[model samples]
Target: MNHLKKCLASLALSLGLAVSSAAAQEAQKIKMGVMQWETIAMTSSVTEHLLERHGFEVEEVEFQEWGVAFAALGKGDVDVLISHPDYAAADYWERNARKLEKLSVASYGYNAGLIVPSYVTINSIDELNEHKEKFRGRIIGVEPGSGMMRQSENVVNEYGLEYEIIEGSGPVAVAELKSALDRGEWIVSMYWTPSWVFQEFDIKFLKDPKGVQEPTETYVWLAHKGFAVQNPKAREVIASVFVPESALTQMTGWVKEGASIDEAVARWEKANANRLDRQAMIGNQ
Candidate 1:
């Protein structure tokens, strides 16, 4: 009887191992590229959760620069990227247009330009010269390579404002903005819209009469060539995901304050379950 029991146990173990191997082989995997920006992180995390529910193993590849993100997509290292093709990525999109497929426009109304606290009494880019001293002749800007900073330089040159463009990171710029606001001091910084900071702080964009800044651009989901053909359900989810301006601002704001991407996504999902379901439905359709 003991010999029979041992044989039965060995047979069961072999069957179990075979089943596990089959399951692993059947599991589908998808890779997505994302930037370190709060919005990108939040969106990518939310998508990851949703895809996992549908039996897909999702991987997020982080790229510091949008340029690198595009290259990864071209090389097929990453499958998808939720990005703004018309504005910040226009140059890259132009180069990779044939290589990538735009699946859907995920969000819109992204604006980039100079901004200041509403109390600063500045209304337009041209008016910066008069209050240059009040702002300490410095325009706090995000990364030097950012399109916003480049446009800011144009604004300075076009308006002939004698201000220095202080190049710092996004977090540093936000910190400076918060400090200036706390002290009720006048300050100008290269800022944008559809950002969590806009919702967190009472700030306004300075008008640009010369149209140096482009109109609001739509952020879209770009897939590697033939990704949709290979993974229809995954494409559906990308199509289904939609983040309104308000929700995006609030969620990204949380991430800016050190919230993990998953935490922020969970919080948003708990509060917006209906919206999440709707997005899924849209994708399936």
Candidate 2:
């Protein structure tokens, strides 16, 4: 009877320890917000792998618009968001600045504007108004609430374009552009850098004579308030991560062609192993 009591007590203690260990692991997990855009998706995927190497789990939550993403961060629903808030999402960041903090700029030379196939004769935003019928009187745009889409609307008004702006999700807009381009059909789609479309297709950004589109912006990672203090190592890794313009476009191009996020990140890691190792080394220091 005495031996059985000792055995039972030992088993209970072991189970309690196991549960506590599991809880600790769960608490170390970091939740990150990501948008549906290609660049953001690829960056988040790579960062997740890097964080895991640092013994931190990453939970990537996809948000549709900048507002929703910032809101989640502000409310502490997410720990961090990988984005270009300074340029593309300036409005949302301003509104939620008090609730969040900008950690580091992860990417540079980011750009977004109107683009057309190389086959299209149109060279500038100003010319679009004259050939609205050629583009079917429509400008394909992404995420209704995105700064890009808002600029697309302004382009229509400022240029006196008689075109309709068709707004959809990022992937949907990309698909529309692909389908149209595949058919050699005319399409003036709102597009940006680090997208596979620019690399995979013969496309060019239409000249913005009116300077409606911001040029060559930087992208940063934003964290919920006090996140840096709570996870200093993770914060260091986030700050150290950097993707050059050429590499970024290539990775996103793969993702644009149906490659899974993990697959794309894996490819990038293998190709840039030295660079990644350097980043990890810097973060550790």
Candidate 3:
């Protein structure tokens, strides 16, 4: 009886080991990519979770910057992504439009542009001209490589505003705007929405009377040139995914309130079940 009991325990241990190995092998499968910006992280996380439910494991790569991300996509360092509709990103797709595959429309966007602190009496972009002296004829711009900065440069030329654009990243631009506004010193800076800037700072988008900026844009999800063929399941999940402006805004609000990326994403998934389709199944890989 003692020998039989020992034999039974050995068999159970081997079976447990086999089960663990099989589970590890199943978990080893995954999809990989980056969210081009923090704005899309939470929403994409929802898509990621939806894909996971459909039997996919996801690996996230911290997308460093727009330009680099685009270049990386072309080389296939990342497998899939969503980005705002902007010239910086447009330049990438325009160059590789034939090489990249369109997945689905993610979000539709509105007028995005430069803004000023609410305290400033300038309700219009034109006001900058009259108050040129107070501003020292200068404008703070987001990252040098950003599409908005390029547009701001054109605005200066188009409106004949005598000002120089100072280059910096989005957060730096916001910090510069807030600090300058606090001093009540005339400050003109680059701005774009779907960001935490409006939530935390007393700012308003400057009116563009000329309507030079692009309007009514839509952000999209994209995959590599031949992703659909190689990963039919990924394509299926991609097709079922898209996020709207309202959804993105809610995520940004959470970020502004000090929620981490993972936390905000988890909250968005739990709160927005209706927006996602659970029946949409990508084949089990």
Residues 68-149, candidate 2: write the lDDT tens digits.
8889999999999877666677888889999999888877878888889889998998998788888998888888776788
Model 3 agreement with the true structure over 140-162: per-residue lDDT tens digits: 88878667887898888888887
In angstroms, give how far residue 43 of model 3 lies from its true place: 2.9
User: Mind giving the per-residue lDDT tens digits that candidate 1 earns over 1-285?
Assistant: 999999999999999998677545542888889888777677777777778777788888889988889998988999999888887788999898888998987777778888899998779988888887899999998887777888888888888889999999878989999999999999898777667888889999988888888788777889878877666667777777767667778877787788877788789999988877776664444
TM-score for each candidate, following the candidate numbering: 0.82, 0.76, 0.74
Better of 1 and 3 by lDDT: 1
Model 3 ranges off by over 4 Å: 1-30, 65-68, 75-77, 84-86, 118-122, 134-136, 179-186, 214-216, 229-232, 277-285
Q: Which sections of candidate 2 miss by over 4 Å?
A: 1-29, 130-147, 166-187
Q: Which pairs of residues clash in candidate 2, taking residues 3 or more apart in a chain or in different chains?
A: 196-253
All models: lDDT?
A: 0.82, 0.82, 0.72
The prediction achieving the highest TM-score against the true structure is 1
State, as a TM-score between 0 and 1, how close model 3 is to the true structure.
0.74
